[model samples]
Target: MHRMKEFYLVSDRHIRYAMMKAFFDARMIEGSSVREHGVMMLSLVEKLKDLQADFNKEETYVDVILQSLPPSFDQCIMNYNMNWLEKNLHELINMLV
Candidate 1:
C-alpha cells in the first residue's frame, strides 16, 4: 500500500509538471482570435486546478496570456501596462477582441 501511494504521488507530480509545461509554452498563433486563445488558456488553468496545482489565477494566468500574445498585440500590452490595467481573463479577451 505504501508503494502504491508513492507511485500515485509520483504519477500525479508528472501529470502536474506536464500541465504546467503546456500552460507556459502556450502561444497565440497568427490568425487566431484572442477569444479562442484566452479560452484555451482558461481551460488549461481549470485543468491545473483540478490537479490541485498551486497558481495565482489573478496574476500568473493573466501574465501568461499576455505573454503568449503575438507581436501584433504589443501596442495593446503596452497600453495595458501603461494604464495599470487590471483585467481578468474574460475581460482581457473581450478587450482584445
Candidate 2:
C-alpha cells in the first residue's frame, strides 16, 4: 500500500493577507511554549512568496491546487486566531499520524 502527500501552489495575495489578518484578530488563550509565532509567520510568508513566483516557470516549485492561501483542517477547525499553532497542533499531528 502507498500513500500520497498533497501539495499546493497558492498565487493570491488576498488570501495570504486574509489569513494574516484573521490570525491577528483572533483572541484566544494560548500556550507560549508549544507555539512559535515566528516560525508560523515565516512559513506563511514563504508560501506567499511562492505564490508570487512566476506563473510560467520552467521548473515550478509548487505543483498542486491552491485551496486556501495556507490550507487548514476541515471546516470544524477553521478560525482566525493568533494561537493557531496551539489550536491546530493536534490537527496537524493527526495528519502525520
Candidate 3:
C-alpha cells in the first residue's frame, strides 16, 4: 500500500510537471486571434488546477498568458506593464481582442 501511494504521488507530480510545461510553453500561432489563444491558455490553467498545482491564479497564470503572446503583442504588453495594469484572465482576453 505504501509503495502504491508513492507510485501515485510520483505519477501525479510528473503529470503536473508536464501540464505546467505545456502552459508555459504555449504560444499564440500567427493566424490565431487573441481570444483563441487566451482560451487555450485558460484551458491549460484549468487542467493544472485539477491536478492541485500550487499557483497563484491572478499572478502566475496571468503572467504566463501575457508572456505567451506573440511578438506582435509587444506593444500591448508594454502598455500593461507601463501602466501597472491588473487584469484577470477574462479581462485581459477582452482587452486583447
lDDT of each: 0.83, 0.35, 0.83
Off by over 4 Å in 1: 1-10
TM-score of each: 0.82, 0.27, 0.82
For residue 79, what is the lDDT in candidate 2? 38
> What are the per-residue Cα lDDT tens digits for candidate 2 across 5-51?
12334435555565555433433223332134334533544554554
Whole-model lDDT, candidate 3?
0.83
* Cα lDDT for residue 12, candidate 2: 56
lDDT by residue (1-97, candidate 1, tens digit) is 2364477766767777888899999999988887888888888887788778967557787888899999999999999989999997788888889
Pairing residues by index, what is the TM-score of model 1? 0.82
Q: Among all windows of ten consecutive residues in candidate 1, which has the lowest summed lDDT? A: 1-10
lDDT of 3 by residue, 1-97 (tens): 2364487765777787888999989989876788888888888888888888958556788788989998899999999989999988788888989
- The true-versus-predicted C-alpha distance at residue 85 of model 2, in Å, is 27
Clashing pairs in 1: none
